[model samples]
Target: MPIEPQALRVLMHLVAHRGRLVGKEELLDAVWGNHFVSESAVSSQIKAIRRATGDTGQTQQVVRTVHGEGYRFVAPVQEEPDAGQPPRESSSADEDGLVSPADQDRPVVAVLPFVDLSPAARHAHVARGLTQDVIAALSKHRWLRVLTGAATARLAGHPDVVEHLREKLGVRYAVEGTIRLDGERLRVSASLTDTAAGVCLWGDHFDRTFQDLFDVLDELADMLVATVEPEVGYAERNRSSRLPRTDLGTWDLFHLGSYRFFQFTREGNGEAQRLLNRCREREPDFADAHAWWAYAVVLGMVYWDTEPTTDLLDDAIQATERALRSDDQNAVFHVLHGRVQLARREYQAALATNERAVDLNPTFATAYCGMGDSLCYEGRYSEAIAQFEHAVALGSHDPQLWAFRTYGALAFLFAHRFEEAVDWTTRAASIPNCQYWTTAHRVVALAQSGHVAQARTEVPDLLEQCPGFSVDYADHKLFYLKRTDQRELYLAGLRSAGVPE
Candidate 1:
């Protein structure tokens, strides 16, 4: 029953020229513009329009075909007031805005067309391009439902645009911004607002040169997408904390679980799993919820020494399978599935799956990290390091930054680059709320670099966090590594760090 964009356009055009025949060529120009699509495209759109409006070829009650000429709207139609007019006040348009009961379950966001603040109107295209780029980039994530910019374009100039978006479009978050041109230089200002809560969650300004517009657009888009996802997550987590337990929806619970999962502690992992379980219970078919729950279970197994029983492994596998079955195109789900493959020592399968994840979302940092992990296990250290670096660059400020850095250090160690391993692991350890496991890598790297004294000093903390750690445990952790020499070298470094035999 959903009207597609092209069909909606056709319907609107028909309504505008009601009672008059609109030529095929005119319809093409109005809808597709300069695009060279075949007449079948228009026919298909007309068919879709008929299906959506319950009009039939036999009846032709609404949209009448003109046989060889074009089409006409035979049905009477009414038009709303022009968008330029002041919006009429309704019960839904109170000071804040109305929130639909259904929309409360998920985060809805809309990216408004950027305002052009250039002295010359000729640079308006640049502003529009940036807005499109941001919307395209953000649309790659499956978690947030991103509304089309065109849907909110008219409301962008309203004094109460945020409230309007919230009430009319049911948008929980609104991203609005302006672009300014100063001759050859460009500046962009953007802000993200939690419309329901009436709070500005985050805002920033970006400056660039107008050398190559497309390149600049890509850069700005990447940066904004990277920033927006985490900022939204942070905002949602804060909002979830204030809500009563009974009021929390599946999405809210998942974000709350992720906030705990990223802490990388024993208690946090347990709590994350508990919340993820509840999330899955609430929405069994939610792919993202299933993926995160599987990820949390795997992390508990790897770090928290949770029993990796057959039932536990099956739970993780089934959750991932369910996620992939629901949305195979989702990059995060593929990455989580790849992680399960990696844990099961299916190196080749994991590598291919992670590669597919990257293919699905080239900008997904976690996919690259998963690929790096697989490559490192295959003893392709240099290639793994490259993948890790790409992941780190894309996710520099992401919640998984610590994991990227730690994996990068591991890749460096496998490549026999001890000094680089020490440096990256140190940075990972220095990050706020870094996982405890990073210190273990630092100890091994220091020992391998012949800094035995420094390595010895780090041993106590690592031992306290991972008691009963041994060379056998190190070997178990590196089970995916095909090369015995690489695994042995890693164990030797751990041994030199005074880990138990």
Candidate 2:
């Protein structure tokens, strides 16, 4: 009797490790490779193999579950070569577990069907609609490859829904929820999970009156998209961190590089650049890798106290242009390009680029922060502060929270809200991996707000960490500020804080 391909692979893997008691995770790694599947999938495959071999779960003649550990194959079979076919290859049975070439390096997401859970099941339609809307919104992100709602609908009542999705569809993440309507009230609860780890990274419930269906759908879709993006990013970073560097694909490399890029230190920035460049080299057509590589280069110059050389700027611009040429519709690419534009001191153009990014994906927090940076350069400090505020609200748990808070502090400083600036910088400085600049910003805010003695005390530490930092360097490197008064305000604070001229 012929067995399904997956079951055949499972049989081969078990036969290869017969009597060794392969753990679930080991089986997943050896049989499914990079794909993630729960223990249930392993059991399912074993059952199929046993049925083909005239064995039952009760008999335990072919395979045995070790209970809380793994499975063991007790019965062994001898390998024989058929005369009409080439000899069967030995010891390479697990190669089938590796991801296919086309699917390699692409992270997939599945939005499973939402359960109605209403008393009368009348909210089924609403739940389905919400799932579709969420899938559509998540598709706009460009980084995520969202499986269609219809495709995931088959998994509605599976005992292992997330694992089934991961196993069958190669999904790394899953979005699942339920919708209920009772009288005039509507409630939708949603969660994002890392299917591999079987962990929920984020979950929330949206409660609204059942007045306008479309309005409710729109609000929930926006919230899910905004929340999912950052949470998925955080999950990806954590996953990549635990994997061996050799096992990482281009997607995981990009995530790892992003984690490093946000550390806001010179060494971390250098590592980020290296990792992103490796991603670019491995997958030349991966536009996001190119975009992030460019951003990593720019971060070193702007925040990590590195020299912003003309050659570095040119390389960054070229990489950004390449990314846009490949995927012009990516809001993140536009945001990164805008950052490079900001570094070039083309404030208006950067602003327009970031505006286009926001138009592309309004839920993206970094785009708002990019717009805030451009606005601050144009001397619209109040508008800039508002944009930063909006961004912080949208992505409170963002991995780049340090950068956002630091930017908000700069906006407050430019607006001459000295105490608020001090508060913002103090908070920013407290966050792990925040840059040396947070301390600098705090010092400036302190000195400007009449706490001169306290500000002077921080000078030694700042100088020690960021050698050669002086007001002159700020004047020369911080060309994004168009107005002389704003520039002088920054320099004057540094001077008052006893920074070297």
Candidate 3:
């Protein structure tokens, strides 16, 4: 039952003046300010508020809209006092519709409509299509608050676009791009800017054949968003690190924790958990924190080889449940739930949950990775490999690129495509901070493909990295696979590669 921030702002404004009809113009000015979204945006937020509160346009039990005017909070209400503050008398949101102080700590990004530099602006529609697609894709990330395209449409040609966006909309990051159609080829250049510093943090160009405009738009947007999301995260983590540790807010803690979580090490996982714990303590309903904590819990047990105590599993499950309870429609929550289910050896349940996640956010690479992992466990190797490929394509620059490649390697190995497994594992191991298990996959795949001597040569490096390496650990890692022969094949490869026990 997560109400959107804008909707929540409107809701608070209505409730603050309970029983009084608040005019649409007042709400627009208070909520949108100089950002200049249309009245339709206000209406949409009202609709969202009603949906969240289980009230409808027809019923209007909670928020009563005065036709062609504004809205009123007509529901029975009680004034609740803050622990140390006075009873609320005004909206907690600022004039620009930004929610409470805690919420302002979250990163806000705006994707401006891409400029069409084509002849006579012939490709303007394609430019708009790409902008909208990126906006939709970025919105899937639970950690990010993406401004609707309409909110930034008017700022497309501002002389100081970044400063204007920052001053007016409180945007931390802004994405701007230009589309140029040259003959049959389309060239799209996009950049992400840090609004505060007015620095371009990242930039890239996509050149496509421009055969099917929509298809090209989808592909380019997926590529751009996948790359930009990680850059934004990296920027946030760096920004948070520069702030005083003692003054770190909940969002800062969450970002710091997320940075550590992707390091793929036991110590990193533990540190991530500690940070996320502090984050949740500060904001008990921060669904992103809860979801990341849940994933880190499973990571400790699965990838880091920490003992999987019953209590640990329960902790992961409870965190996921809490996250979903806070925001049921979040794709990341569902993806994390799938990961938890996979850790518990609930193969079918994992697959189904991951499917739901992909349905919610098709551009979310991790959801596809979850489905791939679940499919691998179900012995549906071909399908799993396809998912991994799609995931890699969508998230080529993902911070968790190692995980996606490692999952692909496993999927390939499980399918007895040993050469492809070796190739994928090699790619994964080449990534910075990739875990020893990734190397282990390469060794097993090599041995299976009749390269036992070469595999044996790599075993020493693997043993040095993971001092307690053994066939038993391999068995523990692959326990989720339902097919006994699949597990045996993996173990036999490790055995051939000269792993102990």
- C-alpha RMSD for every candidate: 13.0, 9.3, 9.2
Query: Using Cα atoms with residue i matched to residue i, what is each candidate's TM-score against the true structure?
Result: 0.76, 0.75, 0.81
Q: Residue 499 deviation, candidate 1, in Å?
A: 2.3
**CA lDDT of 180 in candidate 2?**
85
lDDT of each: 0.78, 0.79, 0.82
* Candidate 1 per-residue C-alpha lDDT over 402-441 given as tens digits, one digit per residue, 9 for 90 to 100: 8999989988987889999999988898778676568878
TM-score of 2: 0.75
Off by over 4 Å in 3: 1-102
lDDT per residue, candidate 2, 417-494, as tens digits?
989998888877777777778888888888989999999999998887688989887787675566888888888989
Q: How far is candidate 1 from the true structure (C-alpha RMSD, Å)?
A: 13.0
> How far in Å is the alpha carbon of 442 misplaced in model 1?
0.7
Which portions of model 2 show Cα errors greater than 4 Å? 1-103, 118-121, 180-186, 206-213, 457-468
